[model samples]
Target: MAIPSKTIKVFEELLESPQNRLVEQAVESGRIPIGYSCSFVPEALLMADKLFPLRLHAPGLAGTELADNYLSCFVCSYTRGLLEFAMDGRYDLLKGWVFVPSCAHMQRLYDNLEYLQKPDFNHILDVPRKVNNDTLLWMTEELQMLADKLAHHFGADMSDVSLRKAMEQWNDFASVVQSIGDLRKKPNPPINGAEFHQIVMASLASPKDLILPYILDFKKEIEQREGIKNSRARLMLVGGHLHDPEFIRVIESQGCVVVADRFCTGTIPGFKTIDINNDSPYKILAEYTFAKTLCPRMMEDFDRRLNTIIDTVKEYNADGVVLEIIKFCDLWGVDAMPLVSALRDNGIPVLRLEREYCLGGEGQLRTRVQAFIESMGK
Candidate 1:
């Protein structure tokens, strides 16, 4: 189905604009905005503290010389692009920064960002390697400690009432996003992969207050439309942080319908919500974030992660699995080949594509993707 033009317009406004209008307005109104990138940063905590949690994105960031000087040329492009965005003065409004360790590159970016004196109030939350009762206890205490620090730094109220309210709101947003994802599970899916990617990426770039209404409206439009049953092959895409929708667009353009994904930017982990009823909200956040996450960094849970991908492939009736690894991402680079072997052994066709973080190299990606689609078609 074709998503509503209005929905596409909304996405264009968020993606094409240099800054998020809602975030920019929030900062201009004397509210402090805290910047975060990784999923490990509990956005509910930031909102509960009365801080605007701006999800950091490096929109339109090309190659960078300034960022390259600090980090090696071998670093992941996403981190380097973000560093360039900050150095280029696009992120001056962010009062504080939160760093969650997905890899070594992010840690180095945090360290160098501190040295540069950008976003002076810095925090690092050490989430454990695996999920457990002990992990939740450890993380909740750590969250409480960070809450104290934020309260002191920003002079904002971090009350239980505020936390409950934020949890309710974030949970509502998650419900809406999950509904959108569930649409893809349908035989003739109402929405295509590229449009869905745009919506999710736009949500990351903008606040839920502004983003939710548009998505809800988009959902209604999607429900009223016809399903796309003409695509040649159904595919499941798996990868690390994928913000740009062009990769999905490329796959879709090659007559493959990407009906399932395990992407950081999409619904593998980010779309699920913490159940907020009669629970310590921080503990709920801790459990949901780590327990449901499918990151390659969570080495101990590879079986669980692999099972999730396999289940998605079966559930969606996918013809193939695309292991989309970023070029310099050490974690996924090691992960892709093994996952390819595993999926192929289970009677699933597999394609491993090395990708740049930004929208570059689509021509090369498209040629390879087209060949994969033809292989699946046969």
Candidate 2:
């Protein structure tokens, strides 16, 4: 289906810069832009009154000359690119930052950011390496403390009423995104991987209220449009921190339909609804944050993570899983070893690729994907 030009333009404008048109509008309306990375950060807390969470990304960074002085050459480009962006004043719109020490590279990025920008609010909410009753309680307490700090620093409304309202607002947004995501499950989907990637990336980078209407309109348009025809194999992309939709285009150009994704910025668990029940918003948020599909850093959750992928393959009817990791990402690099072996043990086809933050090597990636699809046919 040809996407409506208006909807495409909205998505494109949002991604064109860290401070997009909607972000400028939101800031002008007196909303504070709080920055965050990692899916582990509970977005609802950042969504409190007068504040919005801006997921930090550098989509088309040309070079990391600035970040290279602070970080080693071996750090993944994702982290380096973000640091470079901050150093270049590209993230000046953000008033604060919440970071999680998900990996050493990220920790270093946080360190550089703190030393360099030292924004109005600089905090890190340490995540538990293992999940348990004690850890859950610890997480709840941490979130409560975070709420208190945000209130103290930014005068944000961290009251239970405000937090609950924020979660509801987030839930509403997630439902709309999930509805659009479910389209890919059809035999022939109205949206392709690149188009869906653009939508998801734009939604994450902009304020929910500002982008929700455009998303709703786009959803309606695509619902009545014809499904894309003539695809080769169905594939699932699993990886970390891929903000470039052009990479998805390269894969799809090889004739495979990327029907599902389990990546950091992509949908799956990130877009899932926050099931609220009869509990304090903090506890609920803690549980929801802890229970997301595990990143490779969670050493004890390997079995569950592996099962999730295997189950996801069947759930999505994917012909194979494409496990792409950023070069020098220690956690995913190490995790990919066992993941490849285990998925193959479970009789699932897997293609593992190493890529950088910025999109490159299209000819090589296309060649590999084409070969993989051909092998799937045989």
What's every prediction's RMSD, in angstroms?
1.7, 1.3
207-275 per-residue lDDT for model 2 (tens digits): 988999999998988888788777888899998888988899899988778888888898887787787
Q: Taking the candidates one at a time, how many backbone clashes does each contain?
A: 0, 0
What TM-score would candidate 1 get against the native? 0.95
The Cα local distance difference test for each model comes to 0.81, 0.88
Error of 2 at 316 (Å): 1.4
Which candidate leads the pack in TM-score? Answer: 2
Per-residue C-alpha lDDT of model 1 across residues 69-183, encoded as one tens digit per residue: 8988889898998898888888887888888888999999998898886565999888776667787798887787878789899998877788788777888887898888898
Model 1 score (lDDT): 0.81
Which pairs, if any, clash in model 1? none
TM-score of each: 0.95, 0.97
TM-score of 2: 0.97
